[model samples]
Target: MSTICLYGSASGGIDRRHVELAATVGRLIGERGHDLVYGGGGTSVMGAAEAAARAAGARTTGVMPRALMEVELPPEGLGELVVTDDMRERKAEMDARADAFIVLPGGLGTLEELFEIWVARTIGLHTKPLAVLDLDGHYAGLRTWLEDLVARGFARPLAFEVVHWGADPATALDHLESAPRERISLPSSEILGSFADFPDDRRERP
Candidate 1:
């Protein structure tokens, strides 16, 4: 009965495997009787996932920024469609609605959403589980970099534990469902300082 938010590419021409994985994740969510929250795009991975979820009887919700309405194409027949003034508002709504998060292969937008949610969880903003499905090793480099941060003493051990990675959708969902419901309340400044040397340009301003 949890509301799971999925973050992924909205582009119409992403890799076929990624799209298929997204659809599979959606079907699984529906089969488990969980609701889905996602970006309200009617193209690419997002569209394929939502379509599958709806077909399987999952309650689907979509949040879209007004500016990207035309570009992303608002999906139809969702249980709910929330249109916000900007990207920040859209993300906020999604975060507030979701009980857990699952990230599929995507680009900058997807990365931004994942990092922000992870940071929020690390700082005790929420006690929800976060998972990344690494379809075709798409997140291999990112995982390595995160591990390096832990090894370098930049990020706390809890930071590494906040994200659960799986090679496929089923495994990721299993990890998420079995995760403990406890929020890590580390000092916000300390958590922020861990990424002090992270590249400024890589940070997205919402």
Candidate 2:
């Protein structure tokens, strides 16, 4: 089984469409027998997604920064909860636990998580599906920008293709499970930097 990491807003303003889709994501993850791996925040997208997953009897795990936990408690229930020192630690822990990544409507923090995972995958740190739950063209502008980067030769075309987009949760998962996960060797390529050889869970702060 693979752990699917979802990146989304904890408190950003959300549209009703996004909220409904987020709940469906949790249900799908459970129904498909995939576990939910996400940030541990009870108030926002994280909470909504996990709640849906829990309702469907799917396993869920949370990786949280201790600073955030003092205020935004984790969802009421999760199969696993991990607390870390800082943002870096939180990201690393999520990376350590996830085999794939997904994104939903979110703000800066969500974008940050999405980019870090995108960077990690682009540099061959791990090979897994990175999907964008593209509800109501929520990511249309960013998608166009990324394509522009590739057309301008600022990024590899394949790297720009890292984001798989779909309008609904089922289609996203269909894309996610369509391919076999690829595992990269530590230091497999120099593109990202050292630590490729360190164990999958041992990346150092950059």
Candidate 3:
């Protein structure tokens, strides 16, 4: 019923498994009657997934920064193409529009966006579901690194609690769609605000 933010690489051209997973995410977004909000690039995995969703007749919203759009074309097929000032603004826009988040395989950019969402949840800016689409165990090393961080003193086990990971897009979407919506509290605001103070510290769990 609502939109889910999809975070992933706009590059890499997508391998077979990545493409299949992206397509599956798109199909589920459409079949479940939820809208798709994604990076508005016409190349790589971003295009593949958004195209899949659009082809299936889902209302697709593309959020892009002007810089990325200049580097990569804005997808022409979007139901709503929102051009933002920059990458941070683009993320903020998507954060406002999406009810939940689903991350696919991506590079630094993908990690960056998901980190922002996790921080938002931790600090109480939002309480929406956040999930990772771990296709082909692509995120295995990162997950391990997170565990290692938790073992150390740099992060909280509960901070990592913000994310739900899955290998299957169907189950991922199901969890996202079923997440209980809640109102924000002052305590949550302080938690999210702490991240702005601890930008360097959010990379791992304590």
Best by TM-score: 1
Question: Taking the tens digit of each residue's C-alpha lDDT, what string does model 3 give over 55-159?
Answer: 877898898887777776767867988989888898889989988899999999999998888877866778899999888888999989988888984666767
Best by lDDT: 1
User: Candidate 1 on 1-206: residue-level lDDT in tens?
Assistant: 88999999999778998888989999999998899999999889898889888888899999998899899987778888899999999999999999999999999999999999998898788999999988778989988998899899877788867888887788888877889989676676774774666678756544
Q: Whole-model Cα lDDT per candidate?
A: 0.89, 0.81, 0.82
Q: What is the lDDT of candidate 1?
A: 0.89
TM-score of each model, in listed order: 0.88, 0.84, 0.85
Better candidate number, 1 or 2, judged by TM-score: 1
TM-score of 2: 0.84
After superposition, the stretches of candidate 3 with alpha carbons farther than 4 Å from their true spots are 182-206
Candidate 1 RMSD computed on C-alpha atoms after optimal superposition onto the true structure: 6.3
